[model samples]
Target: MTHAELHADAFATLSAWTPPSHGQFSLREAYLGFLAARPDATARSCAPGHLTASAVVMSADRRSVLLTLHPRVGRWLQLGGHCEDGDSSLAAAAFREATEESGIDGLVMDPAPLDLDVHPITCSLGIPTRHFDVRFLVTAPPGAVAVISDESDDLRFWPVDALPPGTDASVTTLVAAAVARG
Candidate 1:
């Protein structure tokens, strides 16, 4: 499918998804607003902003989560980034990003997203933009080894109970939501 088609699919997926039990009611409205504001929300269209897909990667025992020290943000965060051209859906994009960033193969992802967030970012050339992030829950098999991608300064598994000192609250919330779902 073309990039436009893929974006349409993502919008539809978001539209059909039921809001999570703990989610804010405004999230759905914000998502819909994003869809209306940008046609390339699923691709890197960047017409004021774009959509991003992310995963909260959990270890097999469910005690650890893989976090990347983002080079740009300078903070430990979930594995995720911009949706690529060939992605068929938001879930696929999130899975692909998780796999690429974590360097772990054979990962399994939940079809339903664990959380949604809209945040501001300064992209290439210092353009202010928003990332309408759709986050999924991903699981790594026992003994899976993760390699840090060039995009990150470091990659490590953090115990869910003891996230790093500067961990983002959004990441912490996502970990809790993933744990609660399982």
Candidate 2:
């Protein structure tokens, strides 16, 4: 998909999504507004910020979650990254990132977004900017094994309730929601 196509998909996805909470509702509006104002909102080149696709990957048994220790942030985070030109939709981007990072195939994804988060960070552009993250739920097939990707410092499965120390609250929150609804 081209950048404009991705931007349109982002708007449609947020428009069709029914926020799971009031905060999500507000974030959804903000994302929609951003997309409306910026045709390049889906691209990483959008300096102010851009829409990112992310996933909370659940183990086959649904007891543990796969997490990546982000190399840049030095923190454990869910598997995800910027939407790519080939991505047809946000869910596809999320699934693609998860699969690429985990090296696990046959992963199932629910297209509905589970949560939204906006945070400032110096991304690939090497400048401070925010990520309007659209998080989703992805499930690994039985016996899936994760291989750490170059983008991550480490990769492993952690019990949902026993996540490693200093895990970001956003990650913890996403995992909790995924567990509750898994």
Candidate 3:
């Protein structure tokens, strides 16, 4: 499927379900609002119980970012997942997701969150529907090889200027902003 199709499908999956446990209450509420406001849009809010965090893992050279092709969502996404109970902070949760999904060890990530975004999911039913996605900026050593995990069907690096066709626009904006700041 095309990238847009993949994104739409993923959003559909999220919208059909309620937020996860790790999601913040305010974010969850906002997500529901989005779903109600834009039913025609392909995204829905994640339920409170299904909230999760993610990280935008970048190579040390700062030329590329690590992304995973999630099997369920079937979209190219940054490395991230649900925040388990033991995570001390959002950044930690993002870190865990990054490592687990990408299998790139020894990564160094900022202690704080880099950006916050909210997107609606369209997949789950009887759920509040949305993910208040919190993303972090993480760096790996130059030339690090990414090992894809079960969560993702593939793992690879894409150039900052020329990303894969299916990447989220928000991700590109964030990456560009970071590059500008540096």
Top TM-score model: 2
What is the C-alpha local distance difference test score of each model?
0.86, 0.93, 0.64
Question: Using Cα atoms with residue i matched to residue i, what is each candidate's TM-score against the true structure?
Answer: 0.94, 0.97, 0.69
TM-score order of candidates, top first: 2, 1, 3
| Candidate 1 similarity to native, TM-score | 0.94
Candidate achieving the largest lDDT: 2
Q: Which stretches of candidate 1 lie over 4 Å from their true place?
A: none
Model 2 per-residue lDDT at 98: 95
**Predicted structure 1: lDDT:** 0.86
Model 2 lDDT per residue over 63-92, tens place: 999999988889999999999989999999
Ranked candidates, highest lDDT first? 2, 1, 3
The residue ranges of model 2 lying beyond 4 angstroms of the native Cα positions read none
Compute the lDDT of residue 51 as modeled in candidate 3. Answer: 39
- Candidate 1 C-alpha lDDT tens digits along 81-166: 88887888889999999999999988998988788988889866377888888899999999999998898999999999999997
Steric clashes per prediction:
0, 0, 31
